[model samples]
Target chain A: MSDVVIAGVGMHPWGKWGRNFVEYGVAAARAALADAGIAWRDVQLVSGADTMRNGYPGYVSGATFAQALGWTGARVASSYAACASGATALEVARAEILAGRCEVALVVGADTTPKGFLAPNAGDRPDDPDWLRFRLLGATNPTYFALYARRRMALYGATETDFAMVRAKNGRHGLENPNARYRKAFSVDEVLASAMVADPLRLLEICATSDGGAAVVLTSAEWAAKRGTEKPVAVRAISTVTPAFPQTVIEMPNFSTDSGVAVPDAVTPFKSAIAAAAYEEAGIGPEDLSLAEVYDLSSALELDWYEDIGLCKAGEAEQLLHDGDTAIGGRIPVNPSGGLACFGEAVPAQALAQVCEVAWQLRGQAGARQVEGAAVGITANQGLFGHGSAVLLSV
Target chain B: MADGATRERVPAVEGWFSIGDAPALIGNRCTSCGTVFFPKASNFCRNPDCNGEVFADAELSRTGTVWSYTDAQYQPPPPYIPRGDPYQPFAIAAVELEAEQMVVLGQVADGFGIADLHVGSRVELVVETLYSDDERDYLVYRWKPLS
Candidate 1:
């Protein structure tokens, strides 16, 4: 199949919107269309990354956005994979473009998250593992994150200060991002002083949920050239890969990780598998990445991403962060747009937004936090329930 | 309602059971591949190649070791109802069954504190009523320390 180019990318700035999700989505979509110098009526296809609203999302999301945009009738698809929703939506857009079903397609993801922990819906549904976890165990999202973070600390000799330094490092870059929710720089002392949310994690260490929207307009290379765009940002790979079977013990949204009772064999952890898939598809290795954008749900997770994405050796993420190799102006800056830790969790929209950051950085348009001469970049995020994801973007 | 479960009640799903003389704790065994599943497989087998007939019937081992544990500091949103009025923080755990070779998640029994448990600590399953009234009893499972 042919490669797809990202003609335009846009977002409605990630904090709380306090309005219906459609508005932010439409605004982001309009911005993308304007950026591409194309009219809404001219778009041929639509894909949406679903952000669960109330309970499950509305079935007709494409039509929902279509209606809000005054329905010009485009081919529509909606995809869900927890946090990876954004990249998955983009994947669908790229598939349509490559399949020749549509030359120009729009991929949009938006969410106005509920306050506090994103709990399972209200009901007594035994079949539903999300509700079962809450009804039976009262395991909040933070608890799971704490389990993983604490495990990293134990196995990797990663310290709380190392975790705090991740925040301080990201916050330094966040201060330069006008679109970020928390742009104020933080000190290691400040992170240490923050109130504890989980055992080793403080309030500042974890990302908060927020309302945000992002959209990308993708087109075939031929379409871009025809539209007089000299160079369009290309998506090298979109990894919607899942974990292999006989999975090891790990905490998931609704259940404890699957047991490996049948055999002592283990599958690659979901995070590493995501980056590996991206590498294979792109025909590029980690060394080619000029910078990276990763889901920093917690400070520790950022460190985990460093290892998972092959930026450092296993259990050596702290050393890389300490050496400033993953910071702005360093060897390979990570999360130069300020990751989820600083920007807060926008759920669905966030992953698509990461690609937008890559596009800007690769185009040398990323002011302040730009990785000097960045040509290749990668974004990594994990969706729920076996849905792990990443995107390798190149200029 | 912080006050009364007497207002209304509904029976839990029939096939799902935590504990009983019949031995509860749901599971699914693949007829084609003999792959076993816990908490019972509702539909087909998840195995990619073996489009097996998934039979939803099996009893889980009562005794196991604690894989890990943690507590929820905040109240969870809907679909999940907190037993006590409003809601209070409570502990959750993963118990590993040697026979099943899988970890199952459950609430730690009441009065079970975090300090009382550690990974590899022995534990067992128990059928506990999460919430009940004259009309219905919401039966659930818990991981209790093996005494």
Candidate 2:
């Protein structure tokens, strides 16, 4: 597939702003258009990441954003894959540009989240696994996080301090990020002192829901050249792969894993498969990565990503943390935007926000939290059910 | 006629499990490829390579090893009814069944907490009351650590 240049990227600062989601999306869209030096009317396609919390307009986010930016009669598309919504929308726009269906496409995602643990929609739908887990098992999101954290403790000998180190590192990284929700740099002591929501995982260790928005503009390389764009960040690959059959890991909202007795286990586990697909498509290995933005729903999850994305082997992620390899100035810095640890989670907006941060870093525009000499950057995230997303970007 | 009167024991979600002396989770095995599904897959087999449309009721193993465990320190939101007035927290376990080779999640037996559980610890299935209404007692499967 041909590369599509990221002409511009923008975001509304993530916070608990209790306004309508459309407002944030429009603000982000306008900012992205301005950054691209392209008029809204010049865009040929509008792709939006849908937010479930918001009402009708959120469901039709593509048309909603296009209308908010003033109806330009542009073709529009909306995508929803839970937290991977942003990347799914970006993929749609990239495919449109790559297929020669459009020269320029605008992608946007925004969310107005409710406080506390995200719950299932109001209904007694017993068939829905998302609802069944809550009704029968009372398995909230943190339950799964804690399970993974404890598994790491049991299998890899990871300590609470190691998880705290992840929180502290991201806390420090987000201190200089204006777009981050929680900017205060937390100490390991402070994270350890926080209330335990689940065993081995604290309140500070897990991400909260937040309101935020992110937008990006993609154009054909030829279009970018005509606009006098220099050294634009181009998307090398986007992977929206699903898990192989008989997936053994107990993901969120599922009562049980697929039985591995009948069939051989997948060669790569689901999370590892997500980034492996991207790396294969980009024709680059983990060694080529200058930085990464991974979905750290919990502190320990970030460590898992280090291994999943092949930054290190399983059980060696804690050593990577202790060596400061994942810190901003260290080798293969992960989550330089402070990750979800500092950003909370804006669901649909999050994946695109990762892209926005990578774009800024590649262009040397990230003010203080910039990863120096960033070239090849990757974003990895997975949503509920089987939606896996990863994007590889380079300059 | 009184609050203490015998109440009908019911599965929290019908058809997923059974209530008896040897309470077992009722899963279905694909007649063609031998793939098993919990909460039963009556519609179709999920295996990508096999298109087995028929399944038979298979009783899952009563005992397994704990894959992982955790406790809910706070009360969960609705759809989950609290068992006590002040809301006592409960421990949960994901147990790996040897026969099916899949990990299933459930609440640990009423008294067990993170203190009493560890990964790979042996556990057995037991049916217990999850919550009770005026007329019905909702029974759910829980895991009890084998001493």
Candidate 3:
């Protein structure tokens, strides 16, 4: 199969802009087209990441965005995989190009999140697990993050100070990224002093919900060479794997976990399997990654990704941070784009935004927050239900 | 059924726990594989290895150890009911039941905060009124740390 290269990447700065998602997505799409030096009409296919918060158009975002982009009559597709929705869009576009259905594809994701916690759509449907989670136990999203954070502390001797360090490091990187939402630097003490939103996870340690958009232009490696680009960053692999049966971990929107008795137990957790699948498809290991952009929904969760992504051994993520291996100029910089801590979260846009950062870093386009000599990058994120996505990119 | 005149108490989501003094969580244990599931798996065993379609109702352990905990400082959006005058923060806990060998989440009992609990602390399930209306009192499970 031919390699799919990212010819261009673009994003509308992540923050609460109170703008319609269509406008943000369109703006991003135009920027990507201009960057790729391709006309909108020349694109053979378009894919959009779905946003549940938005009404009718969100469900069919590919066509919605296509109509706004002047109806080029290109093949269109839309996907909804919660947090992995953007990657799902990328998956669709990559498949289209690889299948020879299109020579060039445009992928886009955007969202304007509501203030505070995200809730299920209005209704009294008890059958809806998302609704039952909130109505029955009041188990909001943050509660889940806190549960994981606290569990890490208990099992691994991770401390609150360690979580604070993640916020501080990301805060520093955020100041340099103009597209980031919270650009101000925060001290460890400041992070600790911030009001506690969930036990063991202060408000500073959590990512906020925000509005943002990201887009990418993708083409076959041959086409990129034909376009005369000396070197185009290529997506080596995209892994979208579901959890194994008898899921032991208590994930979101669930009151309980699958029983573990019948099965001996999974050697690799779901998150680890997510990244491992990507590495396997890319024929690369974690040691080969020059940098990583992980889903830092909470500071403590970032540490978890370290182990999941194979940057470190299990129960050793805190040590990796302490050794500064995850810093911008460290052995393997993680989330040098400042991560979701600084970007907050724009849902569907976030996965693409992570890839956008890697695309820029591998191309040496990330200005102040650039990881020196960056060549290979990986992005890891898990969605609300069972969607887990990872994309490996290399120059 | 505490009192004949007491307001009708309803399980918050129905089929979770029954109304009684020694209330235990209602769960399902795969008859063929012996895997237990909370919130009751009705159809089949979730284990991928075992394709057991037979499940029997099982009562989970009433007491467990705290696996982890948190406090929700902000009012979670609907459909979580906020009962206070202007909504108050509440503590939540993830308890690990030894018998079932699974962790379950529940709100910490009233009067207890995050500071009052820690991992490995013993906690027992207790039915408490989550919210009440003119018709009935909505009851849900809470985890109470043993003194």
Q: Best candidate per TM-score, number?
A: 2
Fnat per candidate = 0.42, 0.72, 0.82
TM-score of each: 0.89, 0.99, 0.97
For candidate 2 chain A, the 10 contiguous residues with the lowest summed lDDT are A1-10
Report the lDDT tens digits of candidate 1 across residue range B36-123: 6876665676655557665746777778887766666656665556677766666667777877777777777777756677667898
**lDDT of candidate 1 over A224-335, digit per residue (tens):** 9888864588889999988776666464674645545443444567789899999999899999999999999889889999999999889988889999999998999999
Q: Which residue runs of candidate 1 sit more than 4 Å off their true CA positions?
A: A54-58, A259-267, B1-28, B54-56, B83-88, B126-139, B145-147
- CAPRI-style docking class of model 3 based on DockQ: medium
The positional error of residue A1 in candidate 1, measured at the CA in angstroms, is 10
Candidate 2: C-alpha lDDT: 0.93
TM-score of candidate 2 against the unseen true structure: 0.99
| Best model number under DockQ | 2
After superposing candidate 3 on the true structure, give the runs of residues whose Cα lies further than 4 Å from its correct spot.
B1-5
Model 2, residue A283: distance off in Å is 0.6
Q: What is model 2's DockQ versus the real complex?
A: 0.84
lDDT of each: 0.79, 0.93, 0.90
- Minimum summed lDDT over a 10-residue window in model 3 chain A is located at A257-266
